[model samples]
Target: MKRVLLHSAFWLVYLLQDTVLEFVWVGPALKNIPEDVQFWMAFKAAIAAVLPKLLFTYFILYVVIKEIIKGNVRLSWIILQVMAAFIIIIILHRIVFVYYINPVIYGGVLKERPLFHVLSVLLAVMDIGFVSGVAITMKLLRIQLVAREREKNLIKEKLGAELKFLRHQTNPHFLFNTLNNIYALARKQSEHTAEVVMRLSKLLRFILYESKSNLITIEDELRILDDYIALEKIRYDRLTIHFQREIDESSGKIAPLLLLPLVENAFKHGASESRFDSFIRIHVQLQQGRLTFNIENTKENHTAEEIRDNIGLGNVRRQLELMYKEYDLQLQNEPHLFSVRLYINLTSYAQV
Candidate 1:
């Protein structure tokens, strides 16, 4: 409200000042009038001086301010007409006051003042140049705004594509691991073989339906993770896996299938190769508006070749760069343990 009032007041003061100048400064050359009617002539002179300036100021204010507020002004004809019309009006009003009205009131004939030949033409030319410059500036600002919007949309599209590709890669890697477990059970003719197949089907269904979105509720992601852990549990009944969670329900949404690759990497390096007292630990929590994921696994053999072969972990880093650019992820492969610590700025991820 204050800004709007300020805008209106600015125009009012501007128009009032210009009106005073046009009416008083370049006044008429009065002549041959009785002394008794001098007071009336002064009044006429004031109007003649102020009226033209008011009209010109009003024309400029109307055209530019209206365009700014409404986003466009459709007045090409009026803009052109104003320059000629205002000058003519000013001259005609001066002629009528000097020739007819003054004579009737002062009781003597007064001659008409000659029209301003050079001043009229100059005023018109300057007004045209000023209006043209304003129009060009408005057009340039609009073009620059559109270009910035287009650039932001392009970045959003690229991020979405990268996330989709990461999801696709994860799906196959998961399937290969599950099928291998099933193959082992089939060869032994175990009774839990049917149960493992059912679990795999449910996992596939969730990925196909829920994981397609850019973001999903935390509960949905947690459920998928639990189902994955169950499938792995069946494959290795003798191995120990300790899972601890301290997630906040208030966290709104996160990218689906984002953390599964890390879990798969842990199982690959920890459970598949370890022999005795081997364990994989996963701890998740939310604090101070940030989500933290810590995973540590006992690596029986910590080798560079094994870490390079971990395709899912590599893609996770790439996806984080493209999707959550400011995310902090740390990985350490010690002689006895391999650990991954991840922190996501929930505020930043929420924007995507």
Candidate 2:
């Protein structure tokens, strides 16, 4: 329906344009005729001349252009088709003008002209060529626009699939570590085992449900971080952890579960592996739509082989890259300390 309307509008404008041009060309010659009569004669001539032009334009647009775009017809065959159609359309337009238009507009006083006069055929060619060029240009532009839109959609879908796969990778890694914590408590027969299980369930529920969305409120994310920290704290008696938050609640939302993996990495490689007293420091600050998160943890002094990229940090990095265009992730690895700092322009994500 939209295409039909577009074609109709195109032809309507063409007809009006042809009428105005016809009136301008013939007005000075018909000085005795009234202005309204001269305009009526020009309009009627345009209407009569349009039939051949319309046929010629549609033939080239639908038939010749379609075959050329399909790439099935040989170049020689396409040239032959166009040349034959042009000759026939030119003759048809001349017959319409000489027999139909001239007789009516000149009151049958004008002498009969040959069907294939050189000037008339040349004028027909110019008329047909101009309109066909415009039509073909419009057609090619529409095709290019559609192609670009399709390519854009395909890229978006590919990225969405990759993100989902990354999330799948991340979810099991988190579950594995949390279940290990629970397993240790269960084996120890610790009194906090039941409470730990409850917290784990809540965390699991959030992961299974809330984390499905592309973004969630910053407050929701912080709440999940607090829950995970509390659950992990139950496993160790001497672990020192400090989480400081300075958040603007109305700032913006973030990708769900994007930060949990950083905290998980700290607990997995730093505090959990150290034999002596260990500490983890976390600070999350969001002000005026900018978010800065920093996490640091103490680890035992060991060889370089002991420190390596784990799944959690890698997952967080990948998510940040896919989700935010304006963001930074930095890692600082010392002999006894591992630190991560991330900065994100939440307003940019909002714009996206």
Candidate 3:
């Protein structure tokens, strides 16, 4: 639509220049001719006037513009070539107008005058300059537009790479703690030890393979979360915790590893640290291309001098900024509880 409008506007300018402006500027000189003859002569002159300019403009387009853009020709050489071409074009245009068009239109060899010839050639050169100006402007505009599009694509690719990097950067501290849990279980020889190891294997596999992609099904993410929760439960076996999933259209897709950091934080600061009467609650709702993930957990209080390291939440927030242009994340730290609520618009991804 924009191209159509631009072309329409260009041709309208050309039409006005040829039909109206040409006659007004050059008509009074041909007053000796009949009115109809004057109009015909003016029309023929206008056509002949623009023909050489078109040829020169096309030469600039096909050869000069290409060479200049590619840096294959020096600026000084280009200017020299244009000047030499302009001289030849003006001379040929004057010759053609005097020998062919005027004799045929006037029915005789008109005055062989130098001043008139020089003036006409000057006018023709001005028209050629006009054509050159328009051609250069349009060519530069197209080049700029192409450059802008390439820049936009490059930015998208960079953002995508950053988001993937952040996802792949799973907390090393979490892994370190889980290994200690497995070591403790081995010493105890509990039946649940094998189950915990299997869960850990599954969690590692999911992180290494399934979460490699930028997008995955909500169901897949939930399963990853379940494995993680099970591992945490084994690590802190005596905590009273709740994980609730209220899912509709669980097949909805989202960026992988987005919600896991919040859950990890909940366990790190809430359920694992509390002495007694502690609880962690997680709720996930997926329906109609929208996701609401909420986690609230009982937290122990500390003064400003004592604060848990918050690098995990900071890193996840950065990843979310890269993945989503419009999303909702609320982190609330009340006196007794730490809560995180995340909302996402998933209309673009229906399945994994």
What TM-score do all the candidates reach, one by one? 0.64, 0.92, 0.73
lDDT of 2: 0.86
Q: Residue by residue across 165-221, what tens digits does model 3's lDDT show?
A: 666565465576678778978898877888988888887777778887768899998
Instruction: Give candidate 1 regions above 4 Å deviation.
Output: 1-125, 250-252, 275-277, 302-309
Least accurate stretch of 10 residues (summed lDDT) in model 3?
302-311
Model 1 quality (TM-score): 0.64
Sequence-dependent TM-score of model 3: 0.73
Worst 10 residues of 2 by lDDT: 301-310
Q: Which digits, one per residue and each the tens of the lDDT, describe model 2 over residues 1-352?
A: 9999999999889888998998998788778889999888888888888887778778877898789889999999999998998888888888888878888776764455687777777888898788878887898888889989999888888888888888889989989998999899999999999999999899999989988898889989999999999999998777999999998773379888999999999999887898989999999999988999999999896544444567887877877777887999988888878899999998676222
Which consecutive 10 residues in model 1 have the weakest lDDT in total?
22-31
| Colliding residue pairs in candidate 3 | none
Q: How much is the lDDT of residue 336 in candidate 1?
A: 89
In model 3, the Cα lDDT at residue 106 comes to: 49
- Tens digit of lDDT per residue, candidate 1, span 1-352? 9846854675456445544543343334334444334544554444444444445545545655456456665567555666576656556545544555556533443443444546544553454344334444554566678778898888878777767877898899989988998999999998889998999999899899988877787677777778888888777755778888887673457778888888888887688877766788888887665778899988776563444536788788877776664688888878888889998876676343
Q: lDDT for every model?
A: 0.69, 0.86, 0.75
Give the winner by TM-score: 1 or 3: 3
Q: Which stretches of candidate 2 lie over 4 Å from their true place?
A: 108-113, 301-309, 350-352
Q: After superposition, how far is residue 253 of candidate 2 from its true place, in Å?
A: 1.2
